[model samples]
Target: MAILVLSVLVLLLSLYFRLKKRQKNDGLNKFPEGPSHPLLGHLPLMTSTTDVIDVSMQLIRNHGKTVKIRIGPKILPMRTSLLTADSHLTEFILSGNKILKKTENYQFLKHWLRKGLLISDGDYWKRHRKILTPAFHLEVLKEFVQVFESVGDVLIEKLRRCEGTPSCDLHPFVTLCTLDVICETAMGTKMNVQSGKNSHYVQSVKKTCRIIIERSMSTLKLTDTTFWLCRDFYTLKNELKVLHDFTHNVINSKKNNKSIDKNTKRLAFLDLLLKFSQDENILSTDEIREEVDTFMFAGHDTTASGICFTLYCLADHPEVQKQALQEQKDLFGDEKNPVITYPDLQNMKYLEQVIKESCRLYPPVPIIGRYTTEDTEFDGCLIPKYTNIMLFIYGLHRDPDYFPEPEKFKPERFDNFDGSLSYTYIPFSAGSRSCIGQKFAMLEMKSIISKIVRHFEIKPTSPRHEVKLSAETVLKSLNGIKVTLKKRP
Candidate 1:
């Protein structure tokens, strides 16, 4: 009798779920239409990694500017929102508005990220942003130029060692270059991961991203009990535990050591954060760790991806390469080149255009996700609450309307526009959530490109070395991006 009762109850609950799910889909027809599947809803559309950006673009193309997508079970009520390339809607979402909140998918990041700026929302995000903004200021970045120059020179020498090689994987080199910068700039310590054996830190960072991307692809259907019981999840937990121990020990060592003067000439980001930790008006020690970790994650890979794309663009487009080379010659000709001054970088408008163009073609973070907290209307379509919203910058950048001949590599498009369409060409994103390190990132990219183009001419070993992109948090090549680096006289 007891078994019979439980079976009937389970059947009743399943029936209720099917009915509720049907109602949600029926409601979506009243708004913009999107591809849907029974039981799965629009979940199947984004299952593949390669076409996620393309899929988003297709949605926009099929359903106009604003579209509604149903994701997961209807009982969850998480509606996926896409705002197309509508500038007003873009501004609205990124403006840090109260009504539009980060979705619950971000909750998954809390496992690794905690309350860092990237994961925080509302008051916590604002408070941290205020305290952290000072570190990336113009004056502070100016101090890092010497370090940038030194690193650039070292990297050039490293590439010189590979001079005769017909082809090389440039991605690893770019990753090393940026890793060196972040270690110096963020940690005040130098860990040259570029040419040397991979450090524990570098490997750990890559591993974490790979796992996170893999986990993101699957549906989080396991119950807490099931997860606790699972062996695979246990292994993941232990790996993360190791990473946590490593980061914590590094922070603790720096804190306890009194050998280095607080007034040391090198104002590394770690030093700055340490200073903040001491001040009464600033962040607590726990907060300091979160912010430092945030910078550590943010500083390296995104910039590396940007630089890699820039080099690929230059190598692929000879005319653009020629133009960039001329610009470097005109700006800093002859004389085994002085370090790129802030002024020199600022003046290299054409190089800036080239980087922007590369970013358009290959954005580092191809998709930025947000979750809606409340029911919202976007372009006359009802976006139900808890939806995962994806702003597909990759698709938007490639849209023919915004960028004609979008597939062609052309830096000149930026030359015609007077930098007004910042939101339109948001390689670093725009509005309140704009990358805090934009100024620093630009300086590093410009300085590196200036040094590189001036010294060597890059080319592909085979024009047939098909360029491809994959995502492990940041978009990168499936295999490393290999190309020929020819020495220039």
Candidate 2:
């Protein structure tokens, strides 16, 4: 009995010392320490989720642009990570295809997205990316512009209804419009989301995204088992069913369409997927659903955020809005039923700058996370392998060093913008893993904004000072982008 007690005591001592030695050797001791709890590490102290942006802002202000955060329990050291606003460091991490595996928080989304392109890594991601690349071809994208213009017209009509109302939240309206555009172009289905259709699917996607953010930040639901047991998980599971069923039905209904065999000029994203679905193990039904769902999820939400924020910025700055409208007039000339062609979109260079500046101010996908597959060194700091890496694109964009007068809404900044700086000005992100639909997203924004500017004069109900930001599904306005509209002559 005495020998047993002695052996247990030695084992406990060794474990304690081993963990201590490992932590010290990892050089985490040099990291800027966040508020720590005894057993909870930094989790208890962290204001995660949408408010995590505020928390990050504080951390950046207190401890330079680059700070380290240690979340979860001390016993599990994998939760410790480096949060950087350093462009050089961000470039080092994102530029590498080898370290492309997403951080652990993304795992929560796998419950819905499965091994979709956004969530998947390694050879699987490579294969899917290769297959999906043709779907974004210039010819394919130009075909998508027809959907964008039609959707934008519907959105303008929706705004016309609120012409007499005091002011309204623009996000929900804009979100529905983008949902319609993405579904039509990506899935080859006219959802009429702008006409108040697809509410259930829309609600489900939004709810699933909310649950994802909640699950990622909840310490109680750290592991998958714990998350699966929660009420949110069940709700999301049901919602995922609705989303999956909707996509699955659409995909199968069109799977064997005769058009899939032809080398047509009008190849929507799903057409490309359907073309390869019949080949040997190329893509199973579920695999097709994964990509469709991913495109649907990723394609709409981010673009909605971008579009809404750009409108908000324009409304807040009438001069900017006027400049954008003038640029549009120069090309379209108060034309009746002005269908913005691909070239028309390209000419709205000022509007493009406005979108870039707005995105820089309020980046839709504020932060990017990656897991270090190998030990990485940056700025003389060694980030241990398997540690969560956070690139604070939000903070980086707001940094005065890279962008002068970072708080100011200045679209003119992009007038002389240089594209060569891979690290800085990454609203759509940079690197091999940069957003796939960036060009599509840009054209879509230009399409909607130009239409709104020509058809109506948009004004902010509340000033920019009053509008607080919430980093929800995307960077959203807490008070919403409340705007008043007047029909233009």
Candidate 3:
């Protein structure tokens, strides 16, 4: 089987190279300005630093909105990518159903998540999504509000300990709290990350994410053989086992048991999948595990980054934080330990705008990619079937065309904002392939952020320019998001 797989891979490479050679010979036009090396092309440009998010953003400014980039080693011509900074072109690519298959790099995730919705394409993706869409529906997501607010209170209590501190790093607290929420919501298992007992589980998940990212950014490890030869490869496999076992154990615990409680009226994400396993489109154990992993990772990192950055924005703009607190105060007047209902979340309109602006300034996923399934034409250039289109979410959000003075945090941009940025401002991406968990993410972020801002006054030490960003599936601050906290008196 290995021999056959290798043989087929060699044949595919030959065919790909032949097609690319023909296109090169046609000699359409010039490539975008980038540090193209003699043999490595643009590989060295990004591989030199872990800060690819900032690097890619700067490249768009220097090389123009539509920039040509290259990744991977010298051998694979398929490593070349087009960085689309224009919102129209970005919309065009993400909006199309026929061309939305994620690039090959996403396959690297199968070790951790398997062929779940985040990576799978074609019929399988569509079918699985159909089964899972109801899990995130408005009514169903309402069921998880108690879960969100429960974790939110835990996070607030954790932050309360750091009150009156000179400066505190909020990301770690936010990450652990969100991790616990996802585990309970998806796996039906309480990970207790907020209490610090299950720090190992959190580390395993983070380590797995880091390994996947390091593999993507490494020029040598871009190829299967090169990655397999490295010591880190073994580390990734070992970490994968910890995470896989953690998730598998959850499934085993709930396989035969149908326990209902006072809080949960219906089955949660993983519970629903298991509940549906006896139907016509029965999900296998492997399928259930894949979906659980997909939701578990999605539910944890994206919202954590978002809430952290929203706090960063609040810390940066004191006036905005004041307004948010005022809004919260209006909702729950002098009632300490107030219940944050779903209706309260909806009424916090100004806070919602603040979250939108925060997402614009520091999006969770910096860059999203898709490979053309067939020859596609855009901006009067023919994009070959296998070419990589790196949609710069960071760049698109900050583009001057859609957003004037995009650098500044202006929550007013979304004030009475009639969803004009349907294509332009894609914090959760756009079109059919957009994140299904966006509502769930928003609920979690707003819940915790509202709680945090209400309890503590965040004071940012580092300005926006000082905090460095990197693309790690989720956007992260290299210098770390530093802020001082004072309990609201």
Off-target runs (Cα >4 Å) in candidate 3 are: 1-21, 25-31, 48-50, 71-78, 258-264, 462-465
**Candidate 2 at residue 354, lDDT?**
93
Candidate 1: regions farther than 4 A off: 1-33, 72-83, 220-235
Q: Give the better candidate number (2 or 3) by TM-score.
A: 2
- Candidate that scores best on TM-score: 2
Clashes of 1: 2
Clashes of each: 2, 0, 0
Order the candidate numbers by TM-score, best to worst.
2, 3, 1
Q: How far is candidate 2 from the true structure (C-alpha RMSD, Å)?
A: 2.2
lDDT tens per residue, model 1, 2-104: 9999999999999878867765564344546466775666778767566566666787788865566666664553454444465556666776564434555
Q: List the residue pairs that clash in candidate 3.
A: none
